[model samples]
Target chain A: MSKITSLADLKKKRDELKGGLDIRVKAIDPDSVVQVKVAMATCGIASGAKTVMEFFLEQLERRNIAAIVTQTGCMGYCYAEPTIEVKLPGQDPVVYGFVDLKRADQIIEKYIKTGELVDGIIPVNYQTIDFKE
Target chain B: MSKYSMHLLVCGGTGCHASESDAIVCNLRDELEAKGLMDTVQVILTGCFGFCEKGPIVKVMPDNTFYVQVKPEDAQTIIEEHVIKGRKVTRLLYQDPVSKEMISDSKHMGFFKKQLRIVLRNCGFINPENIDEYIARDGYQALGKVLSEMTPEQVIKEVRDSGQRGRGGGGFPTGLKWEIASKNKADQKYVVCNADEGDPGAFMDRSVLEGDPHSVLEAMAICGYSIGASHGLIYIRAEYPLAIARLKIAIKQARNMVCWAIRFSAQSTVLILNFAMEQEHLYAVKKQH
Candidate 1:
């Protein structure tokens, strides 16, 4: 709350603020936060990626879920337009295809909340640039 | 849950500010308040996003939607269509010139796709006036790291290893220069910063000063500590009134940060501009403002 006057104060301030910034940090360390990314390229938007993104953004708040909802360029699932990648804390990411409003609701309710696998789970054909536990 | 659900980051860089970006912020806030979403949303004015071609850029948080070439009148449409209805205004999206495709994310835009930000990293992200925002992004962490962790020789060694060059006419390695200065023995030492860009349309130094003044101040203090100098003097031209004002504020703020590691007993090592600006140019820039 006060100005950081010394080295110890700077360290304390960094540690305090690091909690709020963990999600945006360049290094991805899986912890208590869930990450939900909506594919929002040209074809993805043509297939209602906007609505799906909005649902995730709003519903997560409504249900008191701690999540970071973001939009990425594309996940290369044009055939299954409006795909979403959800990674719960400490779990590998899962990409779901053909995600409509109903499917998005199921994701927040079943997959994200209850930790149950839902329908429409598309097998991810690619891996992230960095492999994490 | 956080009180605000979203943050609307608007570009307030000089180029965008001149293009009615402030008006866009006002209009957006008014529209949000009318819709009772003001409490749920915050509109923040930030420095340049480096895409001056697309002046007045508005970026929505959480989802990373970048709206380019935004106008004051478009604020209402942005609120109703994008903020409320959850749809991006197609026209405002940055359009790729080659294929004529609309790009929702700024990162994918060609202008920023390949660029790596060094000095301008926090320029567009944080409100320049706020020092706390700058600190949150590790603004003076390097200064602290040097002060608490390393000796002057160690600092010079690290800088030498990095091989960072000064952004001046002559490409001088900064560490070697500091090492040379530290090696010389003198009763009194001084670190002078040349902020004079005599050529017209030279705003690189000015932009950095305006957008992220703390960075300059921190670097100056580091230079002071490294060169065994007790005083730091910045000789800037007077035509840059905005930069001058920002530097004053930054210098004041940095002084408040007590030195804990090694006393920069360099008693408040601050020296403002030497007033080398041409009188005619000062009057011209003042009139333009």
Candidate 2:
């Protein structure tokens, strides 16, 4: 939990996690932990994704919400700062926009815990073509 | 069918998030619960849908209706009209930037109409964390087929024939690189996925890792198999914490497949701001090629 200053230290930390770690880290089972992805690309950081990420980690830990919070790169939505993607098992993943600390707290409490959708959603302006087999 | 029948997918990509995608999600859930349809409607937050120009995107599954630039205030109407009554939110649908015509389906949309999405195949479609969704989309089938049906040489030949250049800036022939590494007489050769995608305006690698991480895993394993290497490394930057996390999940899922013992090493690469020198070197290399 200390500040990681060096690459060696980061590698060591990652190695420790990888060593003897259960494969359950991947959300294979539906009942497992929810995966929360925060966009931390340079654009996202400029828009305050770092703060949003920290908020999610802290809140999830404080509430014991057994979720995995991580960082991602530019989602090409530079207009929407501090974006986040949440994935629950056995369901689809959703992306939320314009996240501040307050909204982050709400997401954790309502959506992560109770499976309730909150405000701060970007309406779909772009269409994504999904190929299903 | 009455319970959890409707799935609401909200765009949580950075762009839409800045536009209040989170608030929209919260309000939508509140309205659903208030309408006593919480159990019947499952609201999920997903990654980017790739139409960044108009964000705060939302998609209704089974029907695949795209709603664009949705504000928190619009959440109630979306839930009331779309979820409750099963009507498309036409006003929120994406309109062509040029034609200004509301395009409901993504396939006909101009942004993605020309993109060939082999790498981005599973993105915006499946729950990234769910292995089943990935598997259902023939995600691991490529790996399984490569592992069981094709030999290292054959796999290398197929990739070489496919003309898939390294997505990395170098654009080197991927198969040739694998062949070089495979041909080298090293006791420990490595198949490294340059997830260290360091382009300024580029999120191609990041999206692949985030949305369809298994593809990268499959591709990396294929690289490993083709290169006669048992280990793989993803040189990702610490700056991309979400990509790292998703890559971590993907590596874990891939390891469970009972194929080769593929090891994942995630490391941060040095970022170069002005690629003037690199670009010069690239031109020189291209001339030789």
Candidate 2, chain B, TM-score (2 decimals) = 0.79
lDDT of 1 by residue, A1-133 (tens): 3655556677677665543332333222224577887887788999999799878877986797878776666677899988998999889899999999999999999999999999999997875574222
For residues A70-131, what per-residue lDDT tens digits would candidate 2 score against the true structure? 55566778888888888886667878998889888888889887889999886556677754
Instruction: Give the DockQ-based CAPRI class for model 2.
Output: incorrect
Best TM-score goes to which candidate?
Answer: 1
Q: List the residue pairs that clash in candidate 1.
A: none
lDDT tens digits, residues B1-289, model 2? 0123346778766567678888988999899879887865677766677887888888775445788888899989987676654456788998787877778767678887787766665576666765555655555556555554566799889989999896655799978887888888887665666766666889877777777777766676677667766556667777676666766766665455323423444445421111111224323423432
Interface alpha-carbon RMSD, every candidate: 11.2, 18.1
Q: What lDDT score is found at residue B239 in candidate 1?
A: 67
Error of 2 at B265 (Å): 6.4
Give each prediction's DockQ, rounded to 2 decimals.
Answer: 0.14, 0.02
Q: Which parts of model 2 are misplaced by more than 4 Å?
A: A1-133, B1-5, B18-23, B36-39, B97-100, B256-289
